[model samples]
Target: MLYHIRCKKGDKTVRTIKEVVGHHFVQGQPGLLMAHCQNDERVFINFDHFDFLDFSNGWAKGEAIVAQKAAEAKKNEPPQPPPEPVINGPGGAS
Candidate 1:
């Protein structure tokens, strides 16, 4: 089961989890939801600040979201300049 977690205020999708297991902790009473991502990464999300989307039906939507995020990241990044030419010793010979 795939799941998408996002920030509620900005609606920005934080990460995509392929297999998810939700855990509830009542010790400190922070109301945190813990999920295990596809890469076996444990992610903690506060119910107050995040929203979850279940993509069990299909991965098309999830893929779309990922694509959108990639596009956004590419757009926001600055272009890189070419590296300077290396100078050799003596008469410019290697």
Candidate 2:
């Protein structure tokens, strides 16, 4: 879903936000962000930040990312031996 903030000031041309209310160090970039209008609060997080080990039980972080890239690359390559020929029987069903 998408939303337009109806109450915010300025025209639709506003493209940059320079203000920083606060800051906190995060191990990795955030994957999610949420705001609370009434409470004047916000949350940003990367769920994987909690524990690197927990993210991938037996694999290292770098290996996990690399493995995913290898898997994607494998998808683009053609089959090694080529596909086997399909033969149709003349009688009825084979």
Candidate 3:
């Protein structure tokens, strides 16, 4: 789940887990953490002087965990073999 944050510029964007905030960090704002999209990798915000949004388990943190698992799963995915070509000739076994 990718997180979302309303940028200081008032534009909403997807966030990444590498964004550092304080003792913790936030990926996106809050309401955009579960969307499937190609990573933009630039929605992270640093609210250093702002109050923390102490949600249970911290949505950003949770997203990090989930994202890690997802990456691992992708890495473990089985490699697909290439398709065979058609061979139409004498003695060709069907």
User: Per-residue lDDT for 2-80 in model 3, tens only?
Assistant: 3333322223333323332322223333322332224433333344322332222245434544654566667678998
User: Please, what is the TM-score per model?
Assistant: 0.36, 0.27, 0.29
What would you estimate as the lDDT of candidate 3?
0.39
Give the top-scoring candidate (TM-score).
1
True lDDT of residue 3, candidate 2: 19
Q: What tens-digit string does per-residue lDDT give for candidate 2 at 1-94?
A: 2111111223332222122243232323332222222334544433244222122123333444465456567767888996776767876546
Model 2: lDDT equals 0.35
Clashing pairs in 1: none
Clashes of each: 0, 0, 2
Kindly report which residue stretches of model 1 are placed more than 4 angstroms away from their true locations once superposed: 10-28, 51-94
Give the TM-score (vs. native) of candidate 3: 0.29
Better lDDT candidate (1, 3):
1
Clash pairs, candidate 2, are: none
lDDT by residue for model 1 (5-88), tens: 443434666655546543333234344446667677887655544444434544333353454456567767899999887879
Global lDDT of each candidate: 0.52, 0.35, 0.39
Could you tell me which residue pairs clash in candidate 3?
2-33, 4-29
List runs of model 2 lying over 4 Å from the truth. 1-56, 81-94
